[model samples]
Target: MITAEGLTKRFADKTAVDDVSFTVQPGRVTGFLGPNGAGKSTTMRMIVGLDRPTAGRTTVNGAEYGRHRAPLTEVGVLLDAKAVHTGRTARSHLRAMAATHGIPNSRVDEVIDITGIGSVAGKRAGKFSLGMGQRLGIAAALLGDPHTLILDEPVNGLDPEGVRWVRQFVRHAASEGRTVLLSSHLMSEMAQTADHVIVLGRGKVLADADLGDLVRAWTTLGVRVRSPRAAELAAAIAGPAVEIVTTSPETLDVVGVPAARIGDLAAERGIPIHELTPTTGSLEDAYLALTGESVEYHSKEIA
Candidate 1:
């Protein structure tokens, strides 16, 4: 598990990370999400001791990451896939990292196969594609078989297949009781992979909760109803607190009412209902709603 308490970082005139606190529990995949310049990268750097926190503390497992006897065995981190030496081969890079912690050549070979980079293991890092570089970085992280994994944008340059592989890999790791903290801009994939999420904005903790609860809290619950008597159904459900939007001649999008209630109302009125589907909010919806004001860079809509 990873724990941070009042973690803060300042770079000269600006605060890169404000007082932030969150726990990444074991046996579950926790997603780290934020917009650009939200201090997510800075926070991750502080967690692994790449940058010293100006205040508070962060611990991997039970102590500071640097204090671990074998840091690699305790935590595996991949903040930047392109941090490898450009002159070295993929295999050589992994071999060097493993050698630092006395990890054997056999384990290095295993990670190469595990990350599906065996074909490119002998190729120079400089010549590898973006996807290949990411694979090599992941292989190095898994070299020590650590108890905790911290990955930032692991799927940044991956293809569809590689993206799916990462989703499954993190889920499998968590199932085995390993702590996994993942950062990604892909909300759809994060929604499918993470059990919980910690959101940061402007270097401060904006929200932290289970993924389902976060979505429900930040977005409206609605039910999509399709019926020939859509207008009548909308009128029936209309109230001071309820909202009904007409999407089509035969369909209505409803809020402040449950699907069962809508179905019951339709049945009572003898209205023919073709479809009554409950539509819940998604992670993307929640993220946007929660971080709307926290966004540092805004792009105007194009005509």
Candidate 2:
């Protein structure tokens, strides 16, 4: 498990992370999310001891990451896939990292195969593609078979197949009771992979809860109804507690009422309903709503 209490970081004139606190439990995949400049990267760096926290503390298990006797065996980290030496082959790179902690060559081969980088293990790191580099980075992280895994944008440059592989890999790791903390900009994938979520905005903790609870709290459920007499049906159900929006000439988007009730109302009004579909709030919807005010860079919409 990973624990942070009042974690803070300041770079000269500006504070990048501000008194953040959250606990990542084991046997589950926890997603880390935020907009640009929200201190997500900075917070991950602090967790792995890449940067010192100005105040408070964070622990990988029960102590600072650096204090572990064999850090690699205790926690596996993948902050940057491009941090490897340009001159070394993928195999050589993994071997070097393993050597530091006395990890045997046999284990290095295991990770290479596990990450599906064996086909290019002999290739130079500098010549590898973005996807291959990410694979190599993941192989290195798994070299020690650590109890905890921290991955930052593991699918940044991956193809559709690679993305699916990562999703399944993290889920499997969590199932085996390993603590996994993952950061990603892909909300759809995160929604499928994470059991819990922790959102950060402007260096502060914005939300920390189960995935379902967070989505329900931040977004509203809606139902879509299609009929030729959409306007008439909408008017019949219009009230202070209900909201209806005309999406198309024959479709209405409704809120504050269930699909079953909407169907019954349409039937009672003698409206010929062609379609009725209920839409629940997604992780993307919750993310946008929660971080709407915390975005540091805003792009003007194009005409």
After TM-score superposition, what is the CA distance of residue 106 in candidate 1 from its true location, in Å? 0.7
Tens digit of per-residue lDDT, candidate 1, span 1-303:
999999999999899899999999999999999999999999999999999999989999999988999999999999999999999999899889988999999999999999999888998999989998999989988989999999999998999999999999999999999999999999999999999999999999999999999999999889999999999989888899888889999999999999999999999999999999999888999999999999999999999
Question: Candidate 1 lDDT (Cα, whole model)?
Answer: 0.95
Candidate 2 matches the true fold with a TM-score of 0.95
Clashes of each: 0, 0
Each candidate's TM vs. the true structure? Answer: 0.95, 0.95
Off by over 4 Å in 1: 235-240
RMSD of each: 1.6, 1.6
User: Local error of candidate 2 at 109, Å?
Assistant: 0.8
Pull out the clashing pairs in model 1. none
CA lDDT, candidate 2, residue 232: 93
Provide the lowest-lDDT 10-residue window in model 1: 235-244
| lDDT tens per residue, model 2, 27-68 | 999999999999999999999999999998999989999999
